[model samples]
Target: MAEQIIAALEKIVGANQVLRGDRAKPYLTEWRRAFQPVALAVVRPGNTGEVAALVQSCADFDCAVVAQSGNTGLVGGSAASDARRHVIVNLERMDRVREIDADNATMTVEAGCTLADAQQAAADAGLYFPLTLASRDRCRIGGNLATNAGGLNVVRYGNTRDLVLGLEVVLADGRVWHNLSGLRKDNSGFDLNDLFVGSEGALGVVTAAVFKLYDPVVQQVTALFALDAPEQAVALQRRLIAASGHNLTGCELMSRQAVSLACTHIEGCHEPFEVDHDWYLLVDLASSAQGHWLHEVMAQVVEHARRDGLLSDVVIAHDDERAAALWHLRESLPPAQVAEGASIKHDISLPISKLPMFLARALPAVREALPGVRPCPFGHVGDGNLHFNLSKPAGADDETFLAQSETAHTVVHDIVAEMGGSIAAEHGIGRLKVEALSRYKQPVERDMMRAIKAALDPDNRLNPGVIVD
Candidate 1:
């Protein structure tokens, strides 16, 4: 049966594009090595037609199909679940920049195109893509849309979903939906694009998309502000937003432990302040008007916050090099955590105003549940998303610490739920958070999602064990 399925997939994408046995190892394994899944074959589809045909072939063979692009997702959304019964549909070879319309301020790119490449394409045309992730160089556009990824620029530009104008998707039944229009205003029925953007491939495979672009930022300011606690960071953020509005492109919050870990593990990362504070806020403001006004506004806001005792220290980047260095520290947090040791991480979000309360309650509860756990919390505080991760105690057994993941998750997630927050934030509810989604999500909401999933993929052939089930 596996051979029959692989042969069919090979016929669709050509024999050279179909990988199996040892060759399929990389596609079968998840990036974090959390789940070592198995698959009959890894099929690289070269175009939308090939993807649709492959999906149909997998369904006819009664084999599950998992849509994967870049395979950089932390969640097991792109990994196969069943041995020999799943065929991985990888889109790496489908990479292409279809079109760029400067008059419309939009660009159309294939699903497999790396985000870094897309950003460069926009830059070459004297525009900005505005979806900036740490993994931009490797993570593809399809996965970004599937996960509805949020990054540094989300405060100003919004999530991957918001940046999209239209999408060309291959539905579960080998039917292609060609809605790739760059029109800003489309009163068409139902807004079907939203259904697939964050579906994690349960509904369809996002083949290509039209994305909104913006003018290049000519003047920018990056700064790191020292604060005593999360509340101070929130207060300062509110002040900055009030003063600068949409010009505030990025605002990140980092705990002392998080910063310390980054500085220790990452070579270029260093503590910018003379005296270490309990917390830090990394923020940047940008404008295309080309003047010192952006900097002046940011400086005035920071100085005023300092006078109000909301900040203890401030280090503003005066050059592009320093700005990149500061961003490097922010982007290096995840890798630094990996370098530190095993961790149980949470990508959760809450209302910006409720952030302090959530942190205050979650930290103590997590500590009580898992004693000696190192709480290293930080993330895009401007957008209310926090990577509240708990590192294992020094000299502790990795397995033993990981064994307590359930307890730690319950302790932290309960608080998040109580505060009207989402258990899964930027990252989609892949296999890891499926159970949590069932537990935290309202019964009606869950039922609706399941109904939609059933309607789209009745056999659950596309990315099984993803968003819905």
Candidate 2:
């Protein structure tokens, strides 16, 4: 049966495109190397029609299909775990920039195109894509859309879902739903494109997207400031918002521990400030208005914050090189933590007003549960999302610390719930968070998700065990 399916896929695409045996080994595991599944073969489709045919073939063969993009996802949403019953459908060959409408401020791009590639295309057209991520050079647009990625520019441009205008998806039955319209406002019923935007391939495989663009920022002012605590950071953010209004583009928080780890472990990194503080914020202001002086505005805001005791120290970027250096510290947190040792990671969000309170309570409880654990909390303070990660104590065994992930997660998640927060903020409920989703998701909401999954992919062939039971 597997052979027959491979033969059919080969006929549709080509023998060279149908990977088997050693060639298919790489597609069997996920990015984190946490989940591995065997598959009969992996198929690389070159076009939407070919993808549709591949899906139809897998359905006819009663085999599960997994859609893969750049394979850079932390969640196990792209690879086949059980090869005997699954076939990997890779979109790497479908990478292409279909069109770019600079006058309309939009771009139509294939799902397999890397995020960096799409951003460059927009930049070359004198526009900005504004979906910047650490893995932008390797992560594909399809995966970004599937996960509804939120990155540095999300404070300004919003997440992948917000930037997307339309999508082309391959349904379970090999039907293509082409709703790739560039309309800014559509009163159409259901808004089907949204259903698949963050579905993690449970409903369909995203093949292409029409994304909204923004005018390039003519002037950007960035600064790094030290705060006494999370409350001070929150206060500064509020003040900046009140002053700059919508011009405030990026606002990220960092702990002293997080900063130290980045500087020590990651190359091309150094401390931005001379005096050490418990917390730091990297703030950016972008303006398109002519004759706008964002630098002066930033300075005024910082002065006010200092007077109010919201800031302990502040340094406005004097040059482009200095500004980039500050950002490097912020972006290096993940890799730095990895180098330190095993980390218990949580990407959570709370109300903007409740952030200080959430941290105040959760921090103590987390320390009590795991004594001497290093709490490295930092993220987008403006958006109320924090990557509150805990690193194992010095001389502690990795296995011993990892074994307490449940206790740490419970302490953090309980505080989040008390503060009316979400457990999973930007990252979707992939296989890693399925159990957590089941625990926290409301009964009605879970039922709705299950019903939608059952209705769309009746056989549960599309990326099984992700976003659904």
Candidate 3:
């Protein structure tokens, strides 16, 4: 049966493009090593037509199809986890920048193009693509759109979903929906592009997209402030946003433990302050309007924060190089955690005003539940999303520490639910968080999602057991 499936895939997209067994191992595994998938074969499609054909062929054989691009997703969304017959449809081969309309401020590119490459392409055209991730070099625009990824710039530019103007998708039935018009406003029928964004490939495969761009930033300022608590960061952020006239592009919060981990594990990442503090806030402000005015705006905010006793010490970056250095400390937190040891991570979001209270409650609860567990909470607090990760107890076994994941999740997520926060923030409800989604989501909302899934792929052939199940 597997042999027949492989032969059919080869017929659609050349024999060399079809990989099986050991050759397909790379596509079958996701990042972070959380979920190891088993697929009958991995097919590489070079164009939209080939992707459509592959999907149609998989439906004909009753084999589930998983749409993958870049495979840089943190959750188990891009890979198959069950033992069912599955064919991995990887889009890495369909990388091309179809067009870049400078006047329209939109760029159309294949889903397989890396985020870094796309950003560079926009930069070459003297424009800016605001959506960025630390994994930009490895993550593809398709996966970014599929997951509706949010990163540092979300506070200013919003998520991948917001930056997109149109999408070219292949539905579960192998039919193509082409609407890459780069239209800013159109109220024709339902907003179909939205259904696929952040759907985690359960609805369809994003073949290509038209992304919105912005004017190139002419002046930018970066600053780091040492604070005593998350509340201080929040308070200072409000002052800066109001004073800067909303030019605050990004604001990130890091716990002392998180900062220490990054300084210890990552090379060239040094502490910004002379003395230690309990928390740190990284600030970014950009303006296309030319002037040294942004620097003055940052300095004034710093002075006000100090007067209000909101911060202890602050460091401001005046040049592009220093700005990059300051930003490095913020971006290095993730890789630093990987080096620290085994940790259970949660990507969650709450009301901007409720972050302080949520932290006040969740911190002690998780610690009391698991004694000596190191909490390294940090993330894009400007947009109210925190990467609330917990490092295992000192000298604890990895397996033993991981065993408490369910307990820790319950402790942390229960508080989140009470606070009206989402368990899955930027990351989608992939296979890893499917059960939690089922438990936390409202029944009405869940039923609507399931109805859409059933209507699109009744057999569950497109990414079966993902998001819906």
Model 2 gets an lDDT of 0.87
Write down the TM-score for model 2: 0.97
Q: What is the C-alpha lDDT profile of model 1 across 365-429, one tens digit per residue?
A: 88888989999999999989999999999888889999999999999899999889999889888
Off by over 4 Å in 3: 82-84
List TM-score per model, in order.
Answer: 0.99, 0.97, 0.98
RMSD in angstroms between candidate 3 and the native structure over all alpha carbons: 1.0
Q: Candidate 2 regions off by >4 Å?
A: none
lDDT of each: 0.90, 0.87, 0.90
How much is the lDDT of residue 217 in candidate 1?
92
1 against 2, candidate with superior lDDT: 1
Please give, for residues 1-469, the per-residue lDDT of candidate 2 as tens digits.
Answer: 7778889999999999999888987766676666776777888999999999999988888888888888887767775677676888889888999999988899999999999999999999999888988888888998998898888877777878898899999999999999877888998688887899889888999999999988888888889988888888788877777787678788999999999999999999887777788999999888777655787888889878877888888888877888898888899998999899988889899887888898889888999999999999989888888999999998899889999998998889888877789998877777888888888888899999999999999989898988888
Query: What TM value does model 3 have?
Result: 0.98
The superposed Cα distance between candidate 1 and the true structure at residue 262, in angstroms, equals: 0.9
Clashing pairs in 1: none
lDDT at 469 for candidate 1?
Answer: 66
